[model samples]
Target: MTDQPAAESTTTITLHLWLDVVCPWCYIAKRRVQAAIGLFERPHDVTLVTRSWELHPDLQPGTGGPVDHDARVPGESVAPGEQRVRIEEAAVDHEIRFEWARAVRANTFDAHRLCALALELGGPALQSAMVERCFAAHFTEGLALDDHDVLQRISAEAGLDERRVAAVLASDDYAANVRADEEAGRRLGATRVPFLVANRTASASDLQSVEDYLGVLREVVTESA
Candidate 1:
């Protein structure tokens, strides 16, 4: 029998990001991932896919109103004040303007639906812009994500058609998509927001440094090559 040559392999890496819009750490993680990508040798070889993971899916909008500060902790007994301080320190270091004291508690299901719509109609860039706007609205502006007006404005800013956004908001357009993403995250054993899956192999949930992300990317690139 004749010997055959090995097939050529592609070096592109896919990063699956599971995040919740209302999760402060997810926002910081997004920034860290961007910084790490910036430092990668072949940044263009990476494809980022942001998936939905709601922190408070059952919380209704405009029901109990915004919390004075974020109260959810990751198996830690830190007081609210100390948590704010710790998060503020990290936010300042990343140049992210965070007003946790003024932040509002919101159900992010609608916002996630908008993101799914953006990804379907516009693509990843629009979806990314939509997610960014959602995070900024919740974490920085203290806007209620479940409010249709707030979502409309944010979606419009992200280049989505205002009327289409309104239609989707009125109906349960992408609820299944959001649920599917959450299901996938659960299947992958993600119990927290900002869970990152690199090249569908390595996964991390705890907040890590940009260098950590870079290391993961480099290892994936080397393995693929």
Candidate 2:
């Protein structure tokens, strides 16, 4: 018999991402992660597990002001106009459209719950679609993240079951999952949004470039191999 080469074994890398829906930085970081994954050698072997992190968790749901140059979380101080400028500059090449004039700063708890529901019902792909929808609605389309009707429409757009989504919105379904995700992020020493971890070992924080994310993914892949 002719000798044959051994088959390559695939190793799975679990990537955990903690983000808030309203965070512009998180949106940018997410795009960077996706870009890095596309450049990875074994992209299919990598699994993304999205988690929840609330930048303004204590803010009342459905209560928010119009997003503007001066918009900021209560009790947190920042130089006026600096934030908008900085984020716009950072996101210039990432295809993000701010639409800040029409944006609202509503609490993202309900959106996080909807994401949890997506994760429960369909897994990471579906959950990512749900998150992307929420992000686009809030950031690009200028929709309120906490509005139930908008959420219903978003959920439907993401191909989730309408009845289940309605149930999730009417009641507190997946709230515990959302809380657990936040608690997990806190335990991981994450003090801010857009926290990412690969293989439960390597981690990166806000605003890292795509190359930085690619480096972290390479470390995970190499160590696993």
Candidate 3:
């Protein structure tokens, strides 16, 4: 009788990230998580999933400008000027070029829809590239994410088919997927952008260091083992 080969064991860990295109913290959090993932032993076993979390869902597509600092952090004792300084200082630590003065606050629904399409058509690498471009466009370049032209350029830059991306932008393709992501985020009790869920076992919404992410990943691995 021929000897039978042993079955190969496989382990996969899903890291779900709920984020908004216009959120600066989400950009920072992404960088931190990426850095941590580089340090992980089983990086190939992990899959990063980006989910939609609209920060300003009610805002119109064309009506975009600098975000109202005071309006965002209501009831806080900190003055807007002081808050700006503090936020800029913190962003420097993450190597993020936060051009808040030129930042445009707009509806990110369409951008989220594009992300969903990226995942469907191009998989995680393309989705990740799309997410990074969206964040950079909003926070670094201070571009309006709601603009279809901008989205098209970003989509093309991320290696998506221009014709397909244009079709998606022209129609309501993947709109339901965007809404589903939002609903799932709500069910997970994620009220803030940059929220991360590791293996659906651990989660956090606040700004965390690379070590913090590593710790969470290690815990998930241990539990799965």
Best by lDDT: 2
Which residue segments of model 1 deviate by more than 4 Å?
1-10, 68-80
Model 2 lDDT per residue over 30-132, tens place: 8889888888777898888789988778888778888664545222567877778778887898898888887888888889999988888899999999998
Q: Where does candidate 1 clash, by residue pair? A: none
Q: After TM-score superposition, what is the CA distance of residue 150 in candidate 2 from its true location, in Å?
A: 1.0
Query: Looking at candidate 1, what is the lDDT of residue 214?
Result: 80
Displacement of residue 193 (Cα, Å) in model 2 is 0.7
- The reply for model 2, stretches above 4 Å from the true place, is 1-9, 68-79
RMSD of each: 5.4, 5.7, 6.5
TM-score of each: 0.89, 0.89, 0.88
lDDT of each residue in 104-158, candidate 3, tens digit only: 8889998998898889888988999999889888877878999999999988998
Flag clash pairs in model 2: none
Better-scoring candidate (TM-score), 2 or 3: 2
Model 2 RMSD to the real structure? 5.7
- Collision count for each candidate, in order: 0, 0, 0
* TM-score winner, 1 or 3: 1
Instruction: Report the C-alpha displacement of residue 209, candidate 3, in angstroms.
Output: 1.6
